[model samples]
Target: MKQLFYFGLAQAKACIFPIIIFLTLAVTKIIDIPFLHRYDLILLVCIITQMLMLALKLETMDELKVIGVFHLIGLALEIYKVHMGSWSYPEEAFTKFLGVPLYSGFMYASVASYMCQAWRRLDLKLVKWPPTWIVMFLSAAIYFNFYTHHFILDFRWLLKLLTIILFYHTFVYFTVRKRTYAKPLSLSFILIGFFIWVAENIATFLGAWSYPNQQRQWEIVHFGKVSSWLLLVIVSFLIVAMLKHLKQTKGNLH
Candidate 1:
């Protein structure tokens, strides 16, 4: 029970920035700020919060680097997606480019931040990990499909199959109170994807961004998005895995 509590606590600690951002956005609708736009306020709050986390030693410099990479990657995707009419930020803000608030990139950084923190807190290790080149290739292909699907055939299903084949033998080892537990890496991807899907629902409900269907009336985001999240989680995982040098060796933990 104590182990479980600590495990939960670690997860909560990882999510601190995202939860705070979500709550702040939710309240912005209710509170009338005379001069500041909601989007600008959100940007300010997210930046200050990130600085505080670093200053307080809640996040390390190395972790900040990983988060920074995600921010840029996310921002690039946001520009492409918004251009392709994927979804939209339906608000006016000076910090926005092509309708995406600069702060929107931080949302993706939050996922990377959580993954980095959780890996350290849980002492995670990878077993039977695929080769780096293959993982990188697949990650690139997966990201490319997100954009090319609009112009060409969507290969998400095929890519997902490749992901399962590549990682089927991979295992994630994590510690809880000095007792280590292992799970299939694919399962971890799915579980994380599901949780992100839930978070997405909450984000949409809070008016962070909205789909065309959502603009008419709020409804549950289609379940198919979970697949997209699962792929994204795999992408995030690979980047962190590479950064941490988590490669499988012949002498495996048993």
Candidate 2:
């Protein structure tokens, strides 16, 4: 019980970025700014918060780079998904390009930030991590399927199956203070994805974005979206893992 209490505290500390974002979302939804549009306000808040986090040394430079990549990757997908009518940013904002508010990317960045922060705080390690080639190949397939599935057949289920097969044997070792713990890598993906899905529900409820059904009336987001988040979480984890490996490799060469 003591270890579990400490574990929760560590997780909360790692979630600082995401917590701030969520609070901003909720607060901005209810409060009105005189001139600034809500979407623009969100964009501004995300930028300033990121800068503050870096200046304070709360987030390392290397992790900032990873967060930046997630931002771009997320924006691209948001642009494409908006074009395809997957969902929308209905609020008006000068920061919007192609109907996606720039802040949307930050929401994705929060996920990467969480993973990176948790990695640092928990002293995470991988056991029996797959070879670089396989990991890279699988990550590419997961991301590609996210795009191609819109046009071609939806291969999400198959990709999910692949994720299970690829990561089932792998384990994540993490320290909650002095007590170390291990769990299947796949299970971590599912857990993070599940929490992201929960966060998504809250975001939508607070008018962050709206689905087709939500546009007409507030409704529960489809449970199927959990699978989508699961796959996305996998892509995020793989990218972080690869970047960490590269950094370590460089450090060793020094």
Candidate 3:
């Protein structure tokens, strides 16, 4: 029972930023602010949330660096996806670049923040992790497929197979309270992907960004997006794993 409480608390802490952003979005819709746009308000809220997390020691400097890396990565992807007409930020804001709001990166950073916090709070570790080079290659390929799919054949299924082959034998061990539990690494990716897909639906409902199909009215995001989120989860997991030197025990299954 105590373990469940701690686990829930940790999850809540991980979601603090996302929850705040969601609430801010909901509030902005009802309250008309002449000076501050919704995007600008979101940017401010994210920045303040980040600062508060640091001030309260909820996030460490090393974790902050990881979040920073995700910020740049997510922003680059946003710019490309927007250019490719995959999705779009329709709102105007001073912090936007090429129609991508700066706060959009925080959405990605929040995932890293959750992973880092969960790693620490849950005392998580990887076993039988794959080589860093292979993981890096898979990450790059997964990212590339997001763009190359428009110009060439989509190899996402191939990449997905590679991901499974690389990490199917791996496991993640995490503690809740004094007890420890383990899960297959690939399963963890799928679970997180599902949750992120749900969150994406909520985000779109709140007008964070819109798919081409959603411009007319809000609709449930396609279930197919869960696969994309699964790939992205692997990318985010690899980045966090590399930072923690998890690849050192590549073949140590025990």
Candidate 4:
């Protein structure tokens, strides 16, 4: 227990800069600034910060491993999506720091940080049924995201589909192999993914973020406005669930 606490403290020390960068961006309205103006520079800064933190080796090796996997997954997906034109950022956000997407690595780091907290607090159990759920949820998510804004479709979809399948299998293999999480966490990711698609679709339909060139007509779904919020809640709960379990376990150990 002491080891875990100390490790966390060390990680925090290592991550101070990246955390500060994110906070500064969030609070300073820099992130919200026009993508054409400063998005690229900001993303470049992010890439640098993450690289530095990763090289520091301040966190647990296990956490880094999971995060590396997530980073690769995010990288692959981002490239595939960009090629497909499913979604894209403005010119300023563009940066191929490592021959792939820049934002993905940042996302990977965040995911790793979140999962590390759970890993410390919980030893997950792997169950067979979760794979089935993963597949189903992914299918629903793809459909939802595509049906919404046509971000994922056409020739690229074939590749995207394959990529999603591969991602799911990889997750299954690692989560099951390491027993880092149980069915609940799997369900959480799947559900959240689906909700994101649905919410994104709703946003497109309502003209929240338009794809002017696509000229795609949205088939009206329901209020749809809440879909994104629903996703956020679910994903947040999943992380919390794992952390809550870990906290309880830590208390018992003490």
Best by TM-score: 2
User: Which whole-number lDDT from 0 to 100 does residue 222 have in model 4?
Assistant: 41
Evaluate residue 107 in candidate 1 and report its C-alpha lDDT on the 0 to 100 scale. 94
Please identify model 2 stretches exceeding 4 Å from their true place.
none
Which has the better TM-score: candidate 2, or candidate 4?
2
lDDT string, candidate 3, 141-227, tens digits? 998888789899999899989988999899999988778989999999999999999999988998989999999999999999999
Candidate number that wins on lDDT, 1 or 2? 2
TM-score of 4: 0.41
| lDDT (C-alpha) at residue 57 in model 4 | 54
What candidate 1 gets wrong by more than 4 Å, as runs, is 246-254
Ranking by lDDT: 2, 3, 1, 4
Model 2, poorest ten-residue lDDT window?
159-168
Model 2 / residue 78 / CA error / Å: 0.4
Q: Give each model a TM-score.
A: 0.94, 0.98, 0.94, 0.41
Error of 2 at 252 (Å): 2.9
lDDT (CA) for every model shown? 0.89, 0.92, 0.89, 0.46
Per-residue lDDT of 50 in model 2: 94
Candidate 4 lDDT by residue in tens digits, 1-254: 65556545644643454454455345434345553434455456666665665687544555555556556655665566556664444333355633343654554355445545433434433333224344445444543453345543433345344434444433321232233333433344555456445644543453332343434654544444344334333334333334444556688999
Model 1 TM-score is 0.94
lDDT of 1 by residue, 145-210 (tens): 888989899999999999999999999999978989899999999999999999999888888899
Best by lDDT: 2
